[model samples]
Target: MTTNRTVQTAADAALWLAVHRGWHVLPLNYGTKTPLRGCADCRAENTDHTPQTCPCLARGDGALCHGVWAATTDASVISRWAQRWHTSVWAVHLGASGLLAVDLDTRPGPPPRHPLNGLPWPADEPPPVDGLDTYATLAALSGGTVGDTFTTDTPSGGLHLVHEAEPGRWKGSHGKVRDGDDTVRTGLGWQIDIKAYGGYVVLPGSTSKAGLYRRSSTTTTPLWRPDWLADALARTGHDRTATPAKATSAPAPVATGGRSGPRRYAVGALRSACTELAVMEPNSGRNRKLFRSTTRLAGMVAAGWIDRTEVETALAAAAGHAGLPAGEIRYALTSGFNRPLPVPDIRSAA
Candidate 1:
């Protein structure tokens, strides 16, 4: 196993650590957070393919093509990537790895007038200046101090509080809170970003232009995020009530037998599938459900009963809502689309 082998490079070490910790990871551009670009074929505008349908990925080429979607916990894949991008920086896919990263960034400005609505800063004392202080303030308001956990100091003098969580339980969000188009207030206080579902974080032992990401806490095992803190984050950090964005335009519906029977059935099937997927929990085989749903929808697409773009967009949104990351959804969709369509039972529509 790659984890048992002697580390050859910094990338190898990082990959090994990820494997050992059972975290899904992908290679980033050396010394940067950017994901490596796709193969030339994938980048070509003439080729109509997605990360899921890419020939190179299908062949197990270990090509860094689809950004975080290419992340894997598979040891062999990580080994191949480590040997190839020996100097690459590795990033943990927080959602896929069943973790959440609380990022406290450093800022250079006066503190906000009100960081948290109910918890105001003392007028007699100095205000909070950076993320760390803001986080501390939030913690105190939530009825606890910042407890020890798996913490890392970022190159830019920020902190990452790594916590264990079920994947897709929370969505990633920026530090600042917004009400429609206007800024309402700082949610988890200013500069404290929540990195959860649909996000990735640079791992420790990685170096960037600024400096190295070093461990700040002695704790090796990450503590379960405190209930109080989780409650605060749910209230302030995550915008769970917001609706998922829909595609701007959809493909024209394919004509079905010069009638709308098949198209109508397909539309109904898509809606049912999406409704089922949206409410699934992380431990409920959500990925498998997503794959099965995609396969059913793919059969409809292949039969020309519906538009592929519409199916793809709706399924992606549903899977995303269920807490699967964008990459995982694409992978599942690709596999489902490529597989032979199961025998369609149109008796209901008939």
Candidate 2:
């Protein structure tokens, strides 16, 4: 009698590989794409009006509060988690890992006509999944080189285009774009989503009930995001011009000529902070909002896009204007900067 067999890589093995590659990893539940839930304390705190400001997150304690916030490149920690849950799938936090991904859900068929211009693909060749050809056309129109960008194929036969997550860019969800009027519109047509900051994507070599993820026709590493793609995506989400101007007093002046480039970075921090604050309810818990907003700002600092002190000054003024108390704002900003994140290679385009 013959036995049926196939090679299968272990989940932890995937984690080990990703962590070694400098990607900060997070754990997904066994056989599912969802992130493992936060600890009991974090769960309880979610009931609060300001769930975003969970104290456990700011403390840097042992509790795994926000799953994305818990992403790490630490080999020991990755190995420990892998050992604990052999079935856990591997995921890389987008912004923390300095990577971004475009999710394209497609189906086998004649590819749809370009949505914007209604041009058809060449009739002689077998068409790619629906919507993908459209995206390729759009990317080309936007002056991007989509042909060589690293990509992955999902279990159900969709595609993921991986690129560097540029600082000062916003994330999108399931093709939804939030307008300045607080309305939502369909962006990237109907089948694409841009996952950037505050997002995560499953790594290749991970398995689930759906199936395994595999690299799609890519031999090169993921590249720096093409500016055209970023610009096209920015229109779909919170672009710099889309954010409301801060009504708060100006931030304290920062010294010039440091490694962090305090003054220059502060402008980006303020712009990012204003985007966060503009969406919140005016009376929401200041600490929670501060923590959430500062996380992004601190990432800018950590990425060498800005200075830590610059972020601090900008956030303080933003928080104060939003009615958050002085002490709590300080605590939240400090805790946010102190929180763990993947230290990125600012110089590397990959």
Candidate 3:
């Protein structure tokens, strides 16, 4: 077993390793995913729930804040933080740092096998090999040898598979695989969480509440995203497509019609439209803009071109990022259908 001091040393080394390698890092609590509390200035700025225009990010110095905005690669800034918060764990900002971490958790058991066993864990299973099945499946799907990619064993008996990711909109998922009977299985199972786009992961040497994570002896250069892995993850609903729908791509003009005839396009067309709208600029009148976007999106929805849930989910993310109030965001998304858009004139285009 690695001692606490050794674990601490490993974490420090890992921080410097990532920093030297050009990855921006964030300081998290020693044993938690939560980012360390924001510095006084950031906290003061975020006091209100209203959409904020915090200067920390714009300043580009990477001073201090709780979430993704705290990422930085400056050695001096990191040294200062290291001195001030020596016990802090390192969490790489996934999307911003150009890294993707596959967080594989152990499949917790139903109840304690023994009376003295307080936690609900599989009694028969050995202590360290809990998530092997899931890990093996990912390894096979990820198109790499055991030592060909960066990997780590989490302190709490889980795993982290590291991969290099291009700077873009890569989505992540906490997905599960299910058998015909719908019994959830491993590899896309509930126990796995792909940490990407708006997520972070603790590096080797970081101590979690459970214990310290240590890197395996087989660390290697991180590889670019693999095709097989991408498709599997996408089908499992945890990945965003490689090509983001450009915000400039407008939806197909709504044709005059209703449920009266077969729809001109499938749900895919609407999905594409929503994707484009999602990446559009969140202007000053974000509410009005969202309302208008939703209006166009819902037009497709009314014609049965897309599912409401999908449209709502996509638009909600955009609205939330734009700083719209929760109630207003919801209203903007739902109200579009109430004022249905006129179907586009297919003949006019001809």
Candidate 4:
């Protein structure tokens, strides 16, 4: 929907463009990236109302109640929000819009001594000074180059490389690479963050305290992320879900010490489920497959044949590899865990 001629503010124009491009948007506080707070009643410290149950939200009178969850593409909502928060900055919910942003920030202070530690960096080349350099080095390492894309310049002199992604395919992650001891190693170099599922990025042309976020690319169309880059990101541990616990050792056997049949069956079933999940296409019944797999494995968990933590970690990894968003994966796992356990016919098991 076209923005009314009376609403000629830069924020309004950005909101209109984002809505036109099918992006879900919400208003942030003026001169800041923070989402506008909820209504007075909702903001009360002792209030019992949640965003979902708030009367203001139900009546469509509170457009900025739940942060990104309040984001919508409805013209009326956008107009109302723009009118109410005239100077507010507009932000796009990247995942809801099937978009991803590589946020390359410019940090103050001297560069790290060993930014790209393991990567092959030429002795003649200068060390990376910012996120752009880090991304370039990472791209080169992956045998790919940072070609043209829909790029934006942040007010703080950072870059946002906007790319198109399949909906529910990726989740947000910071650029921190950790070691076995949980030591921090290099990640996407430094100052780089991913904004995807469950995250949002400010709209271009919106102004913040530092300055305006301007479009740097000639085209508005975003390019698909290169396969090599995706692989590198996976290797570097981006777009992954955090596991609750690590499986350091095999789960202790259940009390039926003499009977190994059910345990063997559960192990085999878990392996099969993970294998199927890892190979499924992102949009081709992946969610349903995950739910079924989780349900089956959850049955094994209930039977005391496998450790619940192990099952969760393995299934989450497989689902993440298959490009399922973390939120969706968690939902599937939770739903499966709540269902009644299936009776395993273990007559043929070892």
Clash counts per candidate, in order, are: 0, 1, 7, 0
The digit string of per-residue lDDT tens for model 2 on 55-141 reads 765554324566776776766666666656555366777877778888887754333332322122233545444557557756764
Candidate 3: stretches off by over 4 Å = 1-11, 41-53, 110-130, 138-147, 176-187, 241-350
- What C-alpha root-mean-square deviation, in Å, does candidate 4 show against the real structure? 14.1
Candidate 1 pairs with clashing backbones? none
Return the TM-score for candidate 2, rounded to 2 decimals: 0.56
The predicted structure with the larger lDDT, 2 or 4, is 4
TM-score of each: 0.59, 0.56, 0.55, 0.60
Q: After superposition, how far is residue 321 of candidate 1 from its true place, in Å?
A: 24
Model 2: pairs clashing at backbone N, Cα or C within 3 Å: 53-288
Off by over 4 Å in 1: 1-9, 41-61, 117-119, 122-125, 177-186, 237-350
Candidate 4 residue pairs in clash (backbone atoms < 3 Å): none
Tens-place lDDT per residue, model 1, 1-350, is 12222224446645665767888788777545688875765663655777668777777657776667667777888888776665435788888788888899896765566554223344454677788987887776557877888888887899999898866787776665444312224345667788887788877777666667777899866778788766665544264543434334432333333257777788888888887877776546565677777778888888888888888888877777776656557766876776536547777756
Candidate 1 residue 260 C-alpha distance from true site, Å: 67
Kindly give the stretch of ten consecutive residues in candidate 1 with the minimal lDDT sum: 1-10
lDDT of 2 at 84: 61
Q: Who is ahead in lDDT, 1 or 2? A: 1
Cα lDDT, all candidates: 0.69, 0.59, 0.57, 0.68
